[model samples]
Target: MQDKSFSPERQSAFDARFEAQKIAFGPIVFQCVRYAWKRGMLQALAEAGDTGLSVDELAATGRWTPYVLKVVLETCLSAGVVQLRAGRYQLDKTGYCVLSDTITQINLDFVHDVCYVGMHDLDRSLDAGKPLGLQALGPWPTLYEGLSSLPEPAKTSWFAFDHFYSDTSFPAILRDVFSSGARQLMDIGANTGKFSRAALAHDAQVQLHLVDLPQQLAVADITLREAGVRERAHLHPVDMLDPAAPFPAGMDVVWMSQFLSCFSEPVIASILQRAAKALAHDGQVLIMDTFWDRQRYDIAAYCLINTSPYFTAMASGNSKVYESTDYIRLCEEAGLRLVSARDDIGYCHSLLRFAKA
Candidate 1:
């Protein structure tokens, strides 16, 4: 949970000039480290433990020759992902995380399989305010529409990345969601029905309504049905981006988990306006999402703020992880008032409750 990320306080110890070179050749080093992970060099070093292994010893134990091993190891050594002392190489903390940390593993795969190739067109995506990088996957207008069709490791990695962050947070926040004794709950952006599955199972009396695009609804329908919770669910298929589209009405709670960040500011305002219109007089709208500025740790903030480029080039060009203030102002503009807010929810989420002003 702690990171050795560069801090202003570490200015004396962390050399800015050396860091600049790391940025310059980052793509090569990234791939080399990835190659090391996939090729089992880092794992070998991890298993080698305190004594470590000489380059010759490591080569003797593995298929990689000394030259090839040195190529990967020397780069990692410079990156501080591995260390060399007394002619033996060992996995550094960063290297160990690369091999075993779930978050790091998920993120690495997402970037490599989903974003790496498409990121080349980031300049074009930025200039046009479109997900030009999505072209790398297929000819779908957005990633959501193409998700079901994405091929191979890309498709699997995409779902894994999306689910890892979301699925972990549901159990921790479901209690807060149902504490009001609400029987009607709406899940907007019900990706794969994970939240709906949790909500339906948590409270038997609760009737869950799902609103999403037709394509995603198809996937969620099967998931909910398979989970045996589809009996209490209603599926509403509509694209909220359509200005004329109306939200399903009279809900006790409207949930928009990891949803609003898929839009631009004006589009978010419009969606919130529609959600506000659909709310019962006393209904609350719950938004659970990652706001980069709200993170307590620098590493979380670092990983989050960097996700904007992925949005620009791959997901939705104009939508990036937002700050809480941005959402607060948008909600207020839509005639809603923030009633309750909780932060540091499971897996870097904040739950904000809003009611009609």
Candidate 2:
């Protein structure tokens, strides 16, 4: 008889039962929290930047209408995005960074500007294997492009969401990943080149390449220059998924963070293949991404129902969170062997390391 600890039958039974419960009760709590998050974000934005707006003023000057603003503001007030100071609204620090000009659009714009639109098609996306949100927005279907059309303030405010979340795992993960001290590194889809700055600051010897869209490259140039690392920084403006785009061959490390999920399996496969091709013989590739968990059904449900819809909507309707095993398969297919796997930082995120085989 096999030991119970090593029995596949026992594991499968437990995993399946847990998955069933997550799909049931998780949606209700997720919807409640999601509504609260959206409202709080809008309220905080309306209050921040020394441009505080009352509910009436927000309805007049902001995107949300008067009636909607009133309800949402109240919701946000309850959620702690706003403080009721003498019956006036003001932003809390967390609210300020997420909603105001402090971070990226994932929160401020993502909730109202994009997620709301895509959510309308959640059922369709589920049915068609593409996000209805992306389909409704454009022919090609992309969340980043949809938000890309937003005017100032909103566009600038959107950066905070991505920036803040990424920093949560830094220094710790940085120390573990680059303990050996790498010389040259490439940050693919490097938004604002913030990660590059971290790596550069951690090791002065490391030269950096910051690659992203032409528009983002322009922003990154200013940031890197301000940080006094512009001399070591090289900007490459191109879509990361485009095979025709040129990238320097042979690097000590290639890093992609919270970026791969915004792609379909085929595109990610192509990217992995290309990244593997670009690595030096001893070079390593680091991927930071979301993963499914068996122990936490609530978390898994939240990821699929709340988190995934937005990502799918944002990535031109192709992105979906993949299992860790699926990601390993892609790496293997690209001739990269998994060196280490850890879910040390973000509860939802998995840190994967790969080396050319």
Candidate 3:
């Protein structure tokens, strides 16, 4: 499909006013919707069906005062999440999605529990070139370093958001990763060893090497052991940022999934160079990430673009959701060639396959 562009001339003045108001009240509307969903207001409306429910009925059912119900419902109505007719409130298409869509729920929780507060430090993070917002969660310089230790709702939301995006692609990715019949595969940034366990299940003959930080490896160790794949799994603990440290060598395939986006260009180049050196003569390095510019739809592109600020404020400040061209150029700098590029593999991900130059 061709790229989508906004054309003000094609829209009515009313449409322009609507768009302007939506942007102006975006944050408030978001919170109102979230509150409505959490407080059972949306569910009550959805279940009310064609006839819907009046404010008095909803207030009585939810045991909330009509005054409180009116305040939130009005905001929801303004956002097109709900509609009112004959003093009855009904769920609209957007409201139903807000209540039932898994992706929507995940994104909402991630923003509220993880990114919202930290985002206030975006300007400071940009000016200082560091994850200053990370202070809200912990003293760690970046989110990755403190992933295992993030407190309460932030920890839960962080893992949910991270896993939801990557887990769906694993079935297809496992087939692709093992297509060359690679026996020795290295999983870089093997957070929780989810991919390693999947690989072991897919092919019992394949031995897996998982490389990651010591804290993350600890979590992966338990997961692999419980899955009975510990016998075939080897763990290597190393700080990927340390340029002097080298990757374990002679692997048939080096797999990085949603991993490289956690670092800046220089760090990514350094990591790729290490992977290139570690690969066997016939081996390949596979990188799977959500490259916004390569997305098939504008919605996917929009989500990916908005996620860049999370990296600036909470993740490693230097990294972002990169364009595929950026990764291709970095591969060349690291003495590797991009052998293949595949887009639209599971959700919004793109895979770039590289080989030693």
Question: Each candidate: what lDDT?
Answer: 0.90, 0.66, 0.91
Q: How many backbone clashes are present in model 2?
A: 12
- TM-score of each candidate? 0.95, 0.67, 0.96
lDDT of 3 by residue, 87-109 (tens): 99999999999999999999999
What is the Cα root-mean-square deviation between model 3 and the actual structure?
A: 1.7
Q: List the residue pairs that clash in candidate 1.
A: none
Q: What's the CA error at residue 353 for candidate 2, in Å?
A: 0.7
Report the alpha-carbon TM-score of model 1 versus the true structure. Answer: 0.95
Ranking by lDDT: 3, 1, 2
Minimum summed lDDT over a 10-residue window in model 2 is located at 1-10
* Clash totals in order: 0, 12, 0
RMSD of 2: 9.0
Q: List RMSD in Å for every model shown.
A: 2.7, 9.0, 1.7
In order of TM-score, best first, we have 3, 1, 2
What would the per-residue lDDT of candidate 2 be over residues 171-290, giving only the tens digit for each residue? 567876576467779888776677887887777888888767776677678878788888898887777668766667777898888778778888888888878887887999999876
